[model samples]
Target: MINQKSEVKVFPTNLMKQKETTTKLAIILPGAGYTSQGPLLHFSSGHYFKQEHDVLQVNYRFSEAELNPFDTDGFSANVLHTLEETLKETAYDQCFIVAKSIGTIALANLLKHPTFHNASAIWLTPLLHRDDVYQAMLQYENNSFCIIGDKDFCYREERFANLKSNPSLKTLLIPNGDHSLENKEDVLGSIDMLKNVIDGVIQFSN
Candidate 1:
């Protein structure tokens, strides 16, 4: 199912095998404000569903109250608490993640849990400067892929080349896309980039 709302959408999958069923969950952590309703996150969910994996798009809220630096801890704590609750009841065959921006920060914490070990990920528009974000990706380099636009504010000139050293990771750089991997002046170009993002996701995930 396509994720069209700012609510946790779970596309449940069931496969009967001698009266037993199994589920593979792909948790999506979208960027703050952008949400999973956006085209990139939405189409990515479709790809997982097509592969018979249950997609869990975790929708979170961010308010002006969380704007300050101190509140960053509070916000991350909230997101972490939600993740704990989300996983308390289910046991999945293969647990995967698709996180963007702030979601990647939360995911950095999530990766520490033993439950998420060996899990693969697709990190979009990450805050590469952050120690935690890049560290987590590096720790799980073999099981993860990252995509960022060259035009994004976080795109560091000095570190980008070094980041490419990890051949296990598949990193994509959209030419003129900003944080959203979009081209505002050229609508057609933006559309093509979106398609390219989807293709990259499919290739990495599959």
Candidate 2:
């Protein structure tokens, strides 16, 4: 049975719900300029990984309230701080972070911190120039996957190819898809890909 909750926490500012057994937890961070609700209600598709893991979607402070800091660095710092705090409050055997677009950038920055050394991460259309961050994540105790659409504007083929050449990093490219995977209307396809990725994480985490 899939269970769902809304607005479960209120410190770092997030509105989230869970599906399936609450044993395994995955924190999802959406792109910039979007509230937590947007990705939770849209890309998550309700059944992406519900059969095997619980999902928690979070929003940045600026997205939750109107106290705009108006700086990307500050916003990223706030988001990373919130993630760290939230992880402290949650009880899960293993933690996985799924971030999209600008959110992926935040995750990358967070990866540089020693606090997230053991948490697995998946990046969707990550937009950052720091290849070192990705390399650092590969060297961490956790596994990391980078997913990008072939048609994605930010998809630097050469860079991604280079990343994939590294045996430690996993990369998946969706065919004929955009940054949002818009061309793939088949929700089943999305679900399949997500399942495979999650399963791989579970395998590696063990």
Candidate 3:
């Protein structure tokens, strides 16, 4: 976790010491309540680190009031602004973004910027209820992956169908899993599902 003021945590790989001209950056954008230390983001950050990519975890903080209105465009604008400001001092030749829930909203906006237009992305439990988020995913032409659970409130059969149809998009639909990708009725199943998601993220990143 990072300080609220800074809101960015950096994990640099040892390869950075080699002074390579080309650099790969992995950015993790977490949900409002879910910090980078959460299971999915934590493991994904480790994966990217082991792959020799420097990791940047954006730990955006929110008050209870802010959490309730997270679905608003104002929230998305705040996220985009925080992310842009954090990256102002960082540089990388290539970029990969992993975003969850509200973070996915930020990713959608970031995709519009020239700096991140070509970056690959992984969307976990995205807020498909928002038309802008859905439209952003639909129009993105870069390599991207999305994973969502059927039981998640944001999940809509029609919207998932539309996203699945995009050639550049790869998706995983978890049966009976909720917003956190957890299956209340089947603990082991949730674990297995999580592994599958992690595997997909690793392969897609490669």
RMSD of each: 6.4, 8.0, 4.8
TM-score of each: 0.84, 0.65, 0.85
**Cα lDDT of model 3 overall?**
0.80
lDDT of 3 by residue, 1-206 (tens): 12234333332212221144347888888887888888888899899887878777877677777565444545555556665666677678888999999889889988988888999989999999988889989989999999999999999899999997789999999888899888989989989888988998999987
**Ranking according to TM-score, highest score first:** 3, 1, 2
Q: Can you give the lDDT of residue 28 in candidate 3? A: 87
lDDT of each: 0.73, 0.59, 0.80
- Which candidate leads the pack in TM-score? 3
Residue pairs with backbone overlap in model 1:
none
Candidate 1, 151-176: lDDT as tens digits? 88877655666667776667788899
Better of 2 and 3 by TM-score: 3
**In terms of TM-score, how similar is model 3 to the real structure?**
0.85
Q: Give me the displacement of residue 97 in model 1, in angstroms.
A: 0.5
Q: List the residue pairs that clash in candidate 2.
A: none
Candidate 2 per-residue lDDT over residues 61-95, each given as its tens digit = 33423433334455456666666666566666666
Q: Please give the range of 10 consecutive residues that has the lowest summed lDDT in model 1.
A: 10-19
Where in model 3 is the C-alpha error above 4 Å?
1-22, 70-73
